[model samples]
Target chain A: MRTSFKPLAAGVGGVAAALLLWQAASGARAAGGSLPSVGSVATDLGALAGSPDFWSALAQTVGIALLGLAASGLGGIVVGILVGSFEPVRYATRAALEFLKPIPPIVILPLVVLILGPTGQMSWFLVFLGCLLPIVMQTVDGVHSTDPVARDTARSYGMKPVEILVRIVLPSAMPYIGTAMRVSAPAALIITVVAGLLGGGPGLGQSLYLAQAGGDYPTLYALVIVLGILGLLFQLGTRVAERRLLHWHESYREVAH
Target chain B: MDKLMNKRPVLWLLGIGTPALLLAAWWLASAGSTDTFFPPLADIVDRFRALWLFDHFGSDVLVSLRNLVLGYAIAALAAVAVGFVTALAAPVRWAVDPLIHFLRGIPPVALVPIFISLMGFGPEMRVASIALAAFFPTFIATVDGLRAVDRGLLDVAQVYRLSRRDRVVAVLLPAASPQIFSGLQVSLQTAFVVMIASEMLGPSRGIGAMTLLAQQSFMISDMWSGILLLGVIGFAANFLFDLVRRKVLAWYIGSRRLARAS
Candidate 1:
């Protein structure tokens, strides 16, 4: 316990040192009028925390991310299972998936903004597109990795196709699906923020733009801090959820011992 | 799976045919489209040829590419350098761990706004934002790769009394190359996205800015052409990266293949 606490203390010290550096740099540069000190940013954060509008913006961003993730997660799993079950289907779709996967979501930002007109729906849809391909690929990998022997045995034992899929394939795919969720959750948040920032969608990102446009440097910096914390929380929450849900997985079992 | 892969012609056919088919379908389906937002593929292709291939190739595409290449190079070199120092020292790693995590957690696009504040809509801001955003993945991966080097390999190196430079070059770097490449791939993608985001957020001459401007002014075909160029560049980047990876990791991949076969 003592040894572990040492690293934590060191980490806190590092953050403090970084803050000091930021403050010093901002103070020394007379031309850095747009750059605010850490103290002022903190004060702005405190004031913003008391405001109702900040909370709504936070809620809206979270809502878009969650809604997008849920939709993509469901869609990916269903498609992944169907495709993975048939080798020919996998080959048929591989080219399309590979071509589409590497294109960054931002490339479509202009088109989506035009069609949807910078609404929450546009942000939500962008997040969905951003996350869907990775999840589908992961799920397909998980399904392909299902035990062939076990599958054959189930077939020999008179299990129906759907029954085999439900009992055997899905359980095997959960770990991959969990991994996809871990990756996509943060991505969903990032995409949502990008949409707001670039497309003028309502959320903390738009608020950030507004602050920057208005030359409220303190508020802009404060919102960035909020986003950083929110992202950290998302990461931590996903890790915890993955551990809890995948406790029976071999990786977790090995860790437990 | 092995059999399917061995049939090179069939694999090539499937690989090339699918995308070609999709494009053909899109062209046929949208031939008479009346929707302003979803213009006919034919018109978009014409604009793509005129604008991207001829007119703005140097001004927009080449400019964006130069910034991306410079930023990515700076990030990769800096991350590897700093990663070596931080990973070699235990106390430094602990001290900087949270800072790295926090900085990485902030959406890469969000960081662009901070840069805009500090640097104020210059080329420097775009490059700085891209470099910083692209830095984290490679940095983290380098540290992990260095730390996870085989203990026995180090023992062997020490037993041979190898110079520090030789040990790093021959053992540590070769071992870490695969992981570092993966991280670099992610960084490239991040850099591309941030490049677009930065240009879109600022008044710029890049493809992203042109696309947004066209959209706002209702030049639907021009906007589509910009997007089409972006998509092509994105695909080409990944493909090119894979080709380089294959060349660089040829020995590692060959050894793995031999191991699997035996």
Candidate 2:
């Protein structure tokens, strides 16, 4: 019993120790320059819970992240599958995609800002580019990995090409697409935040930047917590969704002896 | 589908052709643009050559690379060490999981402010930010990798009377390397971005700072140049790392191939 509880107890104790150390550090730094202690940060979080501005900022960032995700996910899968279906199209675009994939989408931030003028549009574009390549690559792999024997069987059965693609190929591809969504979701959020901060867009990132610039350390730290929670929720939500969707997948099953 | 392609010599055309065409198209399309915000591609290239190659590669680009290399190295080493230790101890793992998870969720870019206040807006701050950004992914990977080591393998190690150091160094690290490499790859990418972002966040002498300055000063061509240079470096760095990863994983690949054949 002691051993079993040791891990959990130790975990909690570690966290408490960390918080205490942080409080001490901040307290020491107080004379050099002002910084909030762990207690003060907790207080700020409570104060923020009751603030409308905090809620709005949360909503704004959430809205952008979700919108960007949905748009990129759908567009990417559709276009990816479409391109992946044809050998010529896949081969032709492979070079361009490969070249572009290595380059971070943030490279286009300046141009995006120039064209979109720091609106949610700016963030959307950034998020779109961030999530696009992964989705496309996964979709292409999904299509490519469709069992040739299954394709031959569908053909032998006189199934239409579309029928084979939809009935046979799409299901096989679902796992890959799910993985892609999981992989891309965090990227979409990170880029959205970066876009907001740099592009002057409407999101928690922009707000965090503002707080920092204005010397609102409490608000800055609070927003960081908020963003962290948002990221965790997004990650956890996608993981749950992936697990549910892929429950039947062999890969999702527990390891066999 | 793959076999039929052997009859044709289209690989080169398909592989490099499209990107080349796209590049040409960009140059042509932007040739006549009067927009002050977007200079012609040719002009941008010229600016890129002048600014990055001639003017600030030594000063700005080197700084970025220095920060990236040191930070990423620190992140990778620290992650593996910490992960290895935690994997050996369940209590420590449990104690630290929540904290790690919470920190992992925070966008690395968002920590720039906290780092700025704590470390100040200097090279130290930038490197610290980059290391912080890169650390979580690698650490998670290392822990996952170590944990994912086959139970039977550990049993064999024990039966063989392998010491803990031998068990980890000779058996576990190699076995879990694929996951570790994946984590390192992500760390490489994250470190570069964080390097740039931190520079942009503060008054620093790096390509990120240079780009931000150019944009603010409305040096459209210079901004484009910086963007282009960054894109190339990001691409090349990832490509090179991927090659190294492939080389390191050759043994694993061969084993998998043999398994599949059998």
How closely does chain A match the true chain A in each prediction, as TM-score? 0.95, 0.95
In angstroms, the error of model 2 at B113 is 1.3
The best candidate by lDDT is 1
Question: Best-fitting candidate, measured by DockQ?
Answer: 1
Compose the digit string of candidate 2's lDDT tens values, residues B9-113. Answer: 675677677778888999999997898876789999899999999799899988889998999989999999998888888878988988898999998888888
Cα lDDT, all candidates: 0.91, 0.86
> How would you class the docking of model 2?
medium
Measured against the true two-chain complex, the DockQ scores of the candidates, in the order shown, are 0.72, 0.65
Worst 10-residue stretch by lDDT in candidate 2 chain A? A30-39
Docking category of candidate 1: medium
Compared with the real two-chain complex, what DockQ does model 1 have? 0.72
Clashing pairs in 1: none
